[model samples]
Target: MSIMSGFCQISPAGLCVYSNEQTSSITGYSSEEMLGMGWVKAIHPEDRHRVVAKWKKCNANRDTLGTSFRLLRKDGEVVWVIGQIAPFLAEDHRVLGYIATLSDVTGRKKAEKALQLSAERFSKAFNASPSMMAIYRLADDRFVDANNSLLEAAGYSRAEFVGRTVTDLPFWVEEKTRNSITGLLQGKEAVHNLEGRFLTKTGEVRIGLVSAEVIELNSEPCMFVAINDITEQKRAEAAIEVERRRLFTVLHNLPANIALVEQDYSVRFANNYFCESFGESSGKYCYEALYGRKTPCEACRIDKIFQERVSCKWEQVHNGRPYQLYGYPIHDIDGTPLALTMSIDISELKQLKEEMLRLDRLNLIGEMAAGIGHEIRNPMTTVRGFLQFLGAKKACAGYKDFFDLMIEELDRANAIITEYLSLAKNKNIELKEQNLNFIVKSLFPIIQADAMLADKYVALVLGDIPALPLDEKEIRQLILNLARNGLEAMVPGGTLTIRTYNDADKVVLEVQDKGQGIAPDALKKLGTPFFTTKDKGTGLGLAVCYSIATRHKAKIEVKTDSGGSIFVVQFQRKSPVAPQMN
Candidate 1:
């Protein structure tokens, strides 16, 4: 009776009744051969028993039989079918044949299985979602079908929420939400997420950001909304704004020339006083802006600090007006150099610094020359007389050994003079951009060898180093001298630490030695030439370091006691590059 109807003729045993032509083609048998075959033989193997039982039940009752089962084709593959079989009778109501209607059920069965699997995957995704979410009805009201996060927060069972309107929830503030919805329905446009408030089940007010869009669910009108909690973020932003304004107000009252430079060192912000102090129309470089020139002036103290990774102080002529300046780099949150700068005009202080330097340099040179002159000259005169006497005499018994010892003393005197000259005289350092840390790393192995000879252990505690204009050769020499000193200071099996890093506004290099640390008096005399505390020692190493540091405008700081000696070199950034002479 269905629109999709077909008929079949079967015996009471449920087998296809075909004409002679069809029987031979389908069964690979002639009509006579099929007539003797059992109807169950043509039925699918798995369905054969069930089909046979249904046939017997229908025949005994003389009623219609309906069932869906699989039948075997001539090729032995199963084909799904739905069938209605009824008894065919003669006038005496005796069964003669069977009539049946059938339709293929294979496609329908496959589709039903596919639909079931799709539903299972959707269910899993909905339940396992981390975000608070749900399906909603657009026509009736904003109704939540399910939400695990909501259930946990609201303490509501699924049955309590499903088929229930969000408006009826007392915490939702129905009046406000309905007004917004009415506006959306009138416009028929999507509403972006906006901040709103909600009342919790326990009646506590909470903030939320929400947005909704029109959608089709099951071929009907609906809406899908996503909500997020942002109460803390809102509070933090307001507090930050208030603090920022307060700080800005105070910063505008600074007395010195301070400017906020961009990452590229360009003048992004300059105060009214800074503009009055240093005019505009300067080049991009910070030095060019302050000094009004393409190249840095000679004896650039700031440049030396940055270049040599040390501190320096000096006075320079800007347009013939000497400005005693001290400048250093600013560091950002991650300790990277920033373009921010603070400078003060110390022109009046220039005369005081020059006088101090002159007195200090003279006093240093005078004390050093006086202390060594007597001992050095006395020893040399004795060694010279012994050598002259030895040369005057012929080689006698033990004379050669005595002569050798005298010559060794002579060589020691000469070595002292050479070291003193190197220490006091300022050799051209050839300041250029260099990695101080690289110089340290490259010379570490040589330092280790020196330590081995001294029977001491060395430790390298390397830190951060930023690239700058420096002389690799000079820094290498400086590091070599310090490391050698560290080894000599340490007793047998003592440790040494060589560390490098940027210390705030300065590039810092420190050499720490665990040994019989220098005495306070010895430490004070460190930068004076020929002030050695060791036997057979030329005490010009630290003096030469001080000379090199001054020439490069770098600073040498010492921390020494019995525990150990730590020599820290700090360099200021924003110093100009020194020119190379051919």
Candidate 2:
């Protein structure tokens, strides 16, 4: 019989008596060769003995036999087969030959072997992985298995972890996180990078990124989870953020304009002062936002920083105030070019430097004037008396006009000498308790007469001030010199204002002129002896004013702009001294 299965009849002695075509094809042997041959000979050696014993017993007992074994073919190949045999007995109940049917099952056996090999490989890889991994049975929500990484992370042994549910362990620090993960898994949706807090057995918390998916294990659905610990990374980020805030606070409060500009001329960052000065310029073009220009400024300082890729320092003027700017080429972590700029107001510093230079010049002149002033004045007074005597004599009446001009020149020379002597550091002065406002009020009439002669107006404003030690004559001279200078500097109809007030612990006298401001170059030389801006000026007028101010232990400060100028004299307040009783 040639059906789906091979058919063969065996003799009572377990020998093959007859075989069908399918039997010959399955065994790789012909029917003639199999006749009277022991069928046990075709069974593989590994199963031949067991199969022969079972076949003999089944034939003797007149019962059916069922078995599966590897059969050897004629070509030396082995095939897996399953067979069912039934005894065909005679009416006398004696022993009879057996009829057997065999079917090929090699394909099923090979598939089962491949599947076992794959499972073995997967188990080895899962246990050896470095990332924490675990499997939980879906039916009971219990851990079926956990890798070594997961055990070390959770502070548990495999024996203690297996068969334990999520509730039985202190794993997820928050219950909601655990519930969320469970819900996702139950819905058969994958959880990808679900960040959460995890707790170890020692109660230490750790940040982790968890991912999970449903997988089949042991013919049942289970959840496979992977966790990546990121506790250190998170802590480092927080520390960096705190440090950034501290640095920002320091820059914000600094008394300078600080900014970071990108290569595109856009403002990346600006400190509080810079923002207040420029009006919130973040993300805006530096030139347009800061300077209010439609185009980039010519010879821009920050531009040079990027072009040269170096640091630079320069002075610039903004809103009539001078600032010293420092710019540096900088790059970020990504290597993007930028410019870091800081601008500090240097207006007061420049003024102080100029003042020091002027003082140095004054000291040098004072030393020279003290040595020569008295010598020059003695000769000039003697010459002035001789000239006056000659002008009155009849013999020299014809030369009277010449003598009068000579005497007048001699007097002018003597006056200049007196002004020079006042510059001497050891010049004697009489200090008395006198009110500065009273002194200013007393001098206003003379000042007004001079302003009227120059076709200018004069105004006086006096505030309440306590009396202080002052040299009355020196104060009068100081007031006259400053007032005359102010009157000369203005045009017709220009007003001159004189003001006196108490400023802090000092007294302030301000002389203001409504005239074109002094030039910057000349401003630095204002109090230097022999430095003058007027054509008719002997240049000793302001020098004498400065000398008188120095003698009184006062400070002179000048403020000027395009509109006008103000000369301020600050006098230190002093206590009155007790008079000696005769």
How would you encode candidate 1's per-residue C-alpha lDDT over 300-351 as one tens digit per residue? 5444444554544566666645655555555433354534445566754653
TM-score of 1: 0.43
Measured against the true structure, the TM-scores of the candidates, in listed sequence, are 0.43, 0.76
TM-score of 2: 0.76
- RMSD list, candidates in order: 23.5, 5.8
Model 2 lDDT per residue over 1-582, tens place: 438688999877878888888888888999998898887788899998888788769766777889999999999999989888888888997767778888888898889889989888878888898878999988888999999988998898898989899888778899988788889988878999999999887899999899999999889988898988888988987887788678779878998999888988898889999988878998999888767888776757877798889899987777788889899998744467989889898988988787677666777778778998878878788888888888888999999889988888887877787788777777789999999888888888989998888899998888887887899999999989998998988999999999988988899999999889999999878888888998877888888888888889898999898888999999998755789899
lDDT of each: 0.66, 0.86
At residue 522, candidate 2 shows an lDDT of 90
Candidate 2 Cα lDDT to native:
0.86
Which residue runs does candidate 2 get wrong by more than 4 Å?
1-121, 167-170, 182-189, 260-270, 279-289, 293-314, 327-340, 371-382, 420-434, 466-474, 519-525, 546-555, 561-563, 572-582
CA deviation > 4 Å runs, candidate 1: 1-6, 19-81, 87-97, 142-144, 171-197, 205-211, 228-582
